[model samples]
Target chain A: MSEEQDIKKIMHVMRRAPHGSIYTYEGLEMILIMAAYEQDLSVAFIGDGIYALKKDQDTAGIGIKGFSKTFMALDGYDVEKLYVDRQSLEERGLTEDDLVVDVEVMDASEIGRLMNEQDVVIHH
Target chain B: MNIGILLKEGPYNHQAADTAFKFAEAAIAKGHKVDAIFLYNDGVINATRLGDPPQDDRNIAARWTELSLKHGVEVLACIAASKRRGINDEVMIEGGEITGLGTLTDIAIRNDRLLTFGD
Candidate 1:
């Protein structure tokens, strides 16, 4: 197969909040591993998943290891397609400035279009 | 079409596992190849042979083993997630193997479709 054909557009959809459950955390690990394969990988934050990108998160009191900082490192891993649903952020009273990393804030419809283009969509 | 299933929930507590299994069965019935079932997160618990649900309840692990043996579907559990949940080779049901994320990456790449079932 051609090099271009080998690139599968895989999107990891984050729909749960961080710390409450292991979905977001384990999903991050899956993204990190997939990033190394050099495929077209993207991560979308929707619903409470927007909280995963919120800045200054401290898990010290929650007794769970804080991994919010890991989002900032994803760029270095060459997995830069980070997207946030605009409605979800606003509904939660958060702005792009409140996020720890730079992301493309788009409407849910726009994100849905991108999702349609993906070869695989994994929701967490 | 060659379809791969990524199951992210354990049995009983959620319908994700059952739904994924049914989807696989339906896909196979439709003359499609169900390539494999990759278990992650709480989904890794589905591989335990030690689970002793009430006799009246569906035996989830046994169902996976049957799927693997009868239909040639590969049943895989993420090693990292399995280790964290106290699942190992000894506790794994027949045909269920502990694998890495790299295997999952391959499943995503090579399969014609990769469907994820979870909360």
Candidate 2:
């Protein structure tokens, strides 16, 4: 497990909506697993990915399993670095207060800069 | 430097395969080693040799094959994802291979960078 000892900055970019596709949910599963390795991890919510953390999501209506609350469990996994795109939120008419998890609201440029610094960037 | 590529979407239906090919090409052009290209989910279709596009269109599967054939890049599709999508070795492109997720983890561990391309 010497290879596991090497820490890398891994950022999982979520750009798709939940339920409509499995990207967001699967992306969360990835983050949770990577977190166990204790690498420097961050999750970015951009485009429709912003909806993944929206509050009061009732998937019961859609007859699909809802895991919106899973975002909250990320903190316990030590993967607390979550970033939300400011422009994406505005385009979707949502605010920081509307999400289920507390996140650092950042501009696209800021996220892009951080993305450049990562050893891995997993886009979903 | 060694680099790993993770492609998560299929060809034609999305621009992910094109972008990933372009990125891999550029990386190799810059003298960086593209250690591997791991296909997951719908991305597994990119490795299928059965893809036959119109004469006027660019062939995504062929493009990946060219990358591997020319640059020695290992184009791999996840066995789990490939099986679910009916992508077995028989249908794999000349330079493509069906591999397990553990290989992806090894690629991540050994590479200097692991970049992802998707829709």
Candidate 3:
């Protein structure tokens, strides 16, 4: 198949917080590798996943290698499409300004519609 | 329609595997083809034949094997994830394959939908 035809709209849905478990960190790892493929990639931060984009995270106290900075570095990897759930952020009392990275804050229905359009949706 | 399932949690410890299996079965019943079941993270443990759960409990590995045997499903465990969890080919159940992430990319591209079930 031609390279152009192989480009599928893949969305990685991050639903967990960082540090408490390895899901979010490893989920980011998967995104970084997939970024190299140059596909239509977008990451949705819902539920605890919004916490992953929180600013000033100090993992040194937790003794785990904090990879929250990796989210900031996604732009360099050409995986700039980051979407944060509006309700999730509001429920957590967080706003777009509180995040360390720039993201499109969208409603759940909008994200759900976008998800239905994707060829692949990887939930983490 | 061709569907691919990505199971990210281990059996019993989480409901992900059970949910994925039920979804796969439901998809097949609906006349959709289940292209493959790609196991990542602790989900790789679902492919091991060494599992010997209590008689009253559901044997997750055997369930996957049955799905593969009866429905022609391709059960695959990520090589990188499997290696770290000590799930080699020798311990893999029948119809389960140890493959790379590239294989998952192929499954994603070929399938009509790639549904992921995780904790």
Candidate 4:
């Protein structure tokens, strides 16, 4: 068996704008399932993806359910390894307290290192 | 490199596809195996065979084709999404396939990991 044959780490990049974006919820759900089935899976929020992690996602006037709740559901699936770009959060004035789910804070430089470390890197 | 790139953006746009290409190149450079590249939504246009960019600009459409041909990369355009964009296999020049959500389902089931790139 070769190195590639053995599954290691999986990274999900969620960069889509939050309001009225299906990718935000759908993308998070996708990786959450992968992590549930696989042990070494991880997730990263980058660019506009960080918007998905906003502490309170208001979807009422938009006529949809808030997706931040989905982030909390990750625990049920055992999607424990989570990450978010500190700069992205800061640029948007979103502190860790603003995230619906708890996650490790990472800078772009740290994210660069993490991507290289992963066996599979999925950027949504 | 079993890269599952879910491009939700178009070819002419300066978004998902271009950024995805960079990641694909980086994966190859780092000796990763991208077994599959899946395009959903507007991404199906990547294989349109009629995306005629300006002569001086790099042919993004052809670049994708070359990537698959030159390397052993598997480029799959989602059938459902393709129909939405009118990018069916009938419009392909050659060696392109129209797939479905099941294709992405299979990649998630079979590959070591699935990564998605969207706009």
Candidate 5:
């Protein structure tokens, strides 16, 4: 197959809160490995998943290693397509400014449309 | 179409494994090729042969083993995830293998669709 055909559109959908569970953390690890393959990749933050990008998160009290800072490093891996649901942010009274990484805050419908275009959509 | 399934939850405690098995079975019945079932997260628990639920309940691990044997579908558990959960080759069900994420990446690339079943 040609290089163009080799490139697949893969989206990692995050819909869970961080620290409460290991889904989001393991999902991030999967993204890091897949990023090296140079596929067209994107990550969507929905529901409580938006909290994963919240700035100034302190996991020290919970005794879990803080990985919120790792979101800032995604850009270096060329996995820059970070998306956040606007309604989810508003529901939690957060704004793009409150996020640890720069992301395109979009309506859920817009994200849904993008999700339909992906060959793979994994939720964590 | 060739399909790959990513199952991220364990059996009994959650319905992901059962649902994935049903989906894979239906897909195969329709003549679709199920390339593999890649187990990650708590999904590695699905590959253990040590699970012996009540006789009335479904044997999730054995179901996967049967699916692989009958349909040539590969059952792969992530090595890192399996190790963390104390799952090894000795305890793995028949037809299940411990593999790396690189295999998952390849499955995602080569398959026409990659479906994830999780929380």
Candidate 6:
């Protein structure tokens, strides 16, 4: 480790629901790319993007796969680091209890720090 | 480091700018500097001087203006996005400068990291 290896931390900030659009899904795909093809990939859910973390999303009514299920396999991609903003959760009335996965519940300040530490960040 | 904060949607309709600001403020807090915030696609709406939000919503428009005044975060509204959406800055009056792509590239290279946040 004489020379610094490019850790290349990528943070995918998703704040939308599971369907009606491809933004959130596309973001997850990008993170998959980072985790599968690259190195040091992380994700942060912000604003409505945090909604993607709901414990059990019933997307079938909306004609989409319950996205909460895919989140179940995050460990397979080695995308272990997930963060949710405290303010975003409070404003939206969401708490870790409501979420399906364990995420680093941080404030805006912590999320910003995560972004600064990374080599590349993509927000979808 | 090169920090690219992609704004993917309008202020009121999405949280693109709010998330970007949070990231920027946090980056600065940890002693890291944000070189530039690239406004692309719908993200370019943050640059409109004629910013207006509904009475019931928060003022994200004002937040962008404050980033410059308070944090000195260089706001580089994408020339392509700006032109498509109609955003023009002082230095971008002539030629392709109005798009602000050059500023984005400059900031990317100058900063320590480049980040994008699409709403």
| Every candidate's TM-score, chain A alone | 0.97, 0.95, 0.96, 0.85, 0.97, 0.88
iRMS of candidate 3, one decimal? 1.5
* Cα lDDT of model 6 by residue, A72-121, tens digit: 67888888899889999999887899988888899899899988887666
Candidate 1 C-alpha lDDT tens digits along B1-119: 99999999999999999999999989999999999999999999999999999999899999999899999999999999999999999999999999999999999999999998987
Best by TM-score: 1
List each candidate's DockQ score.
0.94, 0.34, 0.50, 0.22, 0.78, 0.13
lDDT of 6 by residue, B4-108 (tens): 555666565666678887888888788777655666656667767675567887666566666666777666665655665667774231111243444543443
B96: Cα error in model 1, Å = 0.6
Give Cα distance to truth, residue A15, candidate 5, Å: 0.7
**TM-score of each model's chain B:** 0.98, 0.97, 0.97, 0.89, 0.99, 0.76
Alpha-carbon lDDT of model 3: 0.90
Deviation in angstroms for A113 in model 1?
0.7
Candidate 6 docking classification: incorrect
DockQ of 2: 0.34
lDDT of 5: 0.94
TM-score of 4: 0.62
Which one wins by lDDT: 5 or 6? 5
- Residues B14-116, candidate 2: write the lDDT tens digits: 8888889889989899999999999987899898888779999998888888888988999999887788789998999999999876677667767988887
Which lDDT values do the candidates have, in the order given? Answer: 0.95, 0.87, 0.90, 0.71, 0.94, 0.67
**Tens digit per residue, CA lDDT, model 3, B11-86:** 9899999999999999999999999999999999998998889999888888899899999999999888888899
Candidate 6, which segments miss by more than 4 Å at Cα?
A1-4, B1-119
Q: Which candidate gets the maximum DockQ versus the true structure?
A: 1
TM-score of each: 0.97, 0.77, 0.87, 0.62, 0.96, 0.52
What fnat does each of the candidate structures reach?
0.95, 0.29, 0.38, 0.24, 0.67, 0.24
Q: What is the lDDT of candidate 6?
A: 0.67
Query: What would the per-residue lDDT of candidate 5 be over residues A26-79, giving only the tens digit for each residue?
Result: 899889888888889999999999999999998889998989998899999999
Select the stronger candidate by DockQ from 2 and 4.
2
